[model samples]
Target: MKSSTMLKAATAVLALAAPAAAQDVTLRIQTHYNPEQTSGKLATEFVEDVEAMSGGAIDIEMFYASSVVATVETFDAAANGILDCDMTGGAYQTGKNPAFQFVGDIMGGYDTPYQQLSWLYYGGGKEQAQDLYNQFGMELIGWWVYGQESLTSTTPVAGPDDLKEWKFRSPPGMETEIFANLGASPIVMDFTEVFTAMETGIIEGTDYSGLANNQSIGLFDLAQHATYPGFHSMPSDHLACNKMVWDGLSDQHKRIIETAMEKLALRSALFFEKANAEAAAELAEKGVTLHNWSAEDRATFRKAAQAAWDDWATRSPEAAALVESHKSYLTQLGLISQSE
Candidate 1:
């Protein structure tokens, strides 16, 4: 009789735990980061957090390094249901609409990751940015701003005047124009060829990843002189899911994903902050000259970016609206004035 009662008790416990053990859905997500990168490692942590918070109802399979498709195709893949989510920068879709450039990276717009995140969270960017993602058939969960990118330059770019006639590798669009305004000759080239181009004297420097990432890739070794606490080009990577799938999720699961994404963004920004600091100290010991531009120099670069931003806005109506919204919000924060 006692044994029978114990069996019943055991069965009840098993019944209660069974639901938690059975995962309701498994999401296939893809990102452009490699597994070895700090961002990639943090992304894996986010996956673990979601599963834990969902009590095993959710499982995420991370495909890193653009293994499933090219980086630019990630958003479309999520929209078409080829993948459940796209974890990449929105700038890749600028080819589809210029509005994406605003959503991706507002080069020289915000000085720090925190300010950019503030614009997204408190300054009404969340809703406005969501509309752009909705048009592409994906839901923008949130963004992880990696902070400003440092440049690897063979010549010391200590001030704006130093940029005059300086040949360097540059990405297309706003970056090219902004530097061109400063009288720098920006050469458009594939990122893979930056090292070779610099080596062959085709370019003198490359505006590349954050200091830590650039160090990992050996850019500092070749360039010798570098820029730190970069004042230009901070891009935002997003976690966007298919709207249909997102809408289908229960409110509880949706909250779990949303909350986890918020945590992921903060953690990612913090990681790069610490990593870049460490990289600077270590590189300095190795005799690399890391330059930080003066306040006046940074402002000059931003002023140059103004015309580029306005020029890009003319590419599409959506782009024009986004640019207006940004200007309005910046004015509200006293970050900009209409006359400037």
Candidate 2:
């Protein structure tokens, strides 16, 4: 995320377009992304559309790069009225409830963003996620999932067994437990240090961003071997508003915000899909070997991941509910058998 901030302002012409009955709202919002990133650019467009749709009555003061607070605190900041919305994600709130882990990034859950989205929109995820957000005094608007993240490695990680051969950067929490059980050494490190760690051979791999994002950061130059069609970690970025603020908004205004957010999600998903595809072609020319693990390997990894999910469910009733919901939905999607 970039550390810069650029305020998007609504024009007076749009202000004149507000319906007389609609209440004018000025929302102060902060996101974990910056203008330089794709997600940030899409979000800026979303805010602009919302402002225009609401005839400028829904003016937003947007801050990028978690300028108002730390990235992880964005949800709580919104809930406490420090900000009007949390344009971050649920994963950072795992400290509050293990259920958040399910909402944020269901590591090794589904193969694609579409599947994860299906569970949310078509399946029961929408209602369940909303309920989870409501408990924290926040209202769930929608989620933007770009795609699964590729694991950058110095050496080839062709299958599950390869993980044990090297120490990689891992996020804190359940992920460490899952990877550790696979006989791999998982080190928790900040994302910024991943390059230097890998350069010095302190770490052999890193659980980084999507294929395109990693390529943009020149990770492929260092770690020529990568697991494409990433097998783990597709985190959902949320657009959540404080429940009180959301409830107080005009129905039309609420719909405007929701509709705009939907567009942002779809646009982001497609953008990343195209980017990764292009990046894949570029990596081929650059001699970077893209690895897509075999189905058997994916299953093995999923089974291990599911075990961690089950253990996490034991941490909270809400977590268990979300896990069961995911299992039922994954079954419906044919990604998991009914017996599983």
- The residue-by-residue lDDT of candidate 2 on 46-146, one tens digit each, is 98999999889999999999999999988988999999999988888999988999989998888888888888888989899888899999998888899
The lDDT for every candidate, in the order shown, is 0.89, 0.89
Please report, as a residue range, the 10-residue window in candidate 1 with the lowest summed lDDT: 17-26
**What TM-score, over all chains together, does every model reach?**
0.91, 0.93
Shift of residue 247 alpha carbon in model 2, Å: 0.7
Task: Give the top-scoring candidate (TM-score).
Answer: 2
Prediction RMSDs, each to the true structure: 4.5, 9.7
Candidate 2 is scored at a TM of: 0.93
Candidate 1, 1-340: lDDT as tens digits: 9999999999999998865433388888999999898899989998999999999888899999999999989999999999999999888889988999998998888877888888889988888888888998899998998788998899988888889999999988778889998999999999999989988899999988899999998997788888888888899999999999888787878888889989998998898999999999999999999889988888788888878889998999888888888788777777677786
